[model samples]
Target: MTTGRYLAAGLLAATALPSAASAGVTVTGVSGDPGFLTGRIIYTPGGIGGNAGTTSADLSIGRMKFTGFDTATAAALAFNTYCIDIFNYVQNGTFDLQTFTLGNAVKEEQLKALLSNTAGLIGGAATLGGKKDISAAIQLAVWEIVNESGNNGYSLSGGLFQVSATHGSAATNARALAQGYLNSLGGWSAQPGFNFSMLSAVSPANNQRQILFAPVPEPGTWALLIAGFGAVGGAMRRRTRTRLAYA
Candidate 1:
């Protein structure tokens, strides 16, 4: 059996974590219907495969082709897409065990609804006169909610859960869409509740390692970011930077 690992290249520009951060299910690969973004969280019942250290989840996006709008030009889009999130149940100092099972049917129902509402929503247009495929784009935004209260192998001990995601570039936008969905309910938030931590993208050679998407930004860097934002805004806006730090 092939153990597939996702490519961690490019940058995704989405909301930063509290300076911290963080799926697929298999009934033989669950796919969202055409024109809608579909996602599933599958459990092995005996826990996930591989290591005994930290348990991590991942979403895979296949390369897609797109075409320009007016000129009808076709081009392959290499988006730096990121911005999906996973949760471990340790919110604040207490143990929130909500990570075990997938949230009730409400979660699944809402996601399907999202796809329906966003139907026919294309990014811009594919170049080369070809239509753009957003299937991978949609998968990039899926998340895993392990154990309900969010505690897991890739998390800290006690009620201290973890969240992770890719930071910088197009990944950020993907993360934003996912965040909007999570925040819509009075349910999930990095502040006031769950703690977040961004995980370094696993090296491509080590396909055994699966990387989970989170809110972006390392846990310790949140306050620094706020200060940096203010400092630059008070004077002249600083130049934006890009990093291929997916690993």
Candidate 2:
């Protein structure tokens, strides 16, 4: 093969390799403070005994902003994420981005359904109360899908995965709303252009894992990346030709 052809092939191979960006993530803060439901989560394996129970303080349910480096450009990337692990705590620390398939098949399917359909329901709400209620419900639904033991279905009451609030009707309403979303998943259709990622913490081994959603890059974006590689190969070939002429 000619030198130019070899250099072009090398550039293509390099672009096809996985990104070498650092996996460190920092939880900046909650996104929009949509709202939180006041309740305790009961899971035998999540460090909290089924008898003792744990409140929202222990398992915070809400959208959070996470800052990390882009896998391709290594640029600062900040996006919204939702907690998927009730067994661990969320702290400002380091985390690694993993594939979404790390969880059970049921968990993955249910989460995709929730995010695709019910997650954006809050955007259509008319009042602050409505928005907060929808946000809390989405979070509750996510918890049920991730931590629930039996694949029977998702629920916030009377199952291996349970959420209860002893104080007011807000929690109760949120639970009902969440259950509605789960029930509708039977006929849910998969949506395209959505990319899901799992953010697993590096330290504090017990830190919570989060789900980050990003839109897939457009065709134009891919074209630009390919063009960039072509430019680099062209520059190298030009330099090689100049050296040969001088020789």
Cα error, residue 118 of model 1, in Å, equals 2.8
Most TM-score-accurate candidate: 2
In angstroms, give how far residue 225 of model 1 lies from its true place. Answer: 39
TM-scores for the candidates: 0.30, 0.67
User: What lDDT tens digits, residue by residue, belong to model 2 across residues 75-94?
Assistant: 55445445454433344444
The ten-residue window of minimal lDDT in model 2 covers 5-14
Q: Point out where model 2 deviates above 4 Å.
A: 1-24, 28-32, 44-46, 49-60, 67-76, 217-247
lDDT of 2 at 117: 62
List RMSD in Å for every model shown: 19.5, 18.1
Local distance difference test values of all predictions, in order: 0.23, 0.45
Residue ranges of candidate 1 with Cα displaced over 4 Å: 1-4, 7-52, 57-103, 122-137, 144-171, 184-247
Residue 99's C-alpha lDDT in candidate 1? 22
Error of 2 at 181 (Å): 0.9
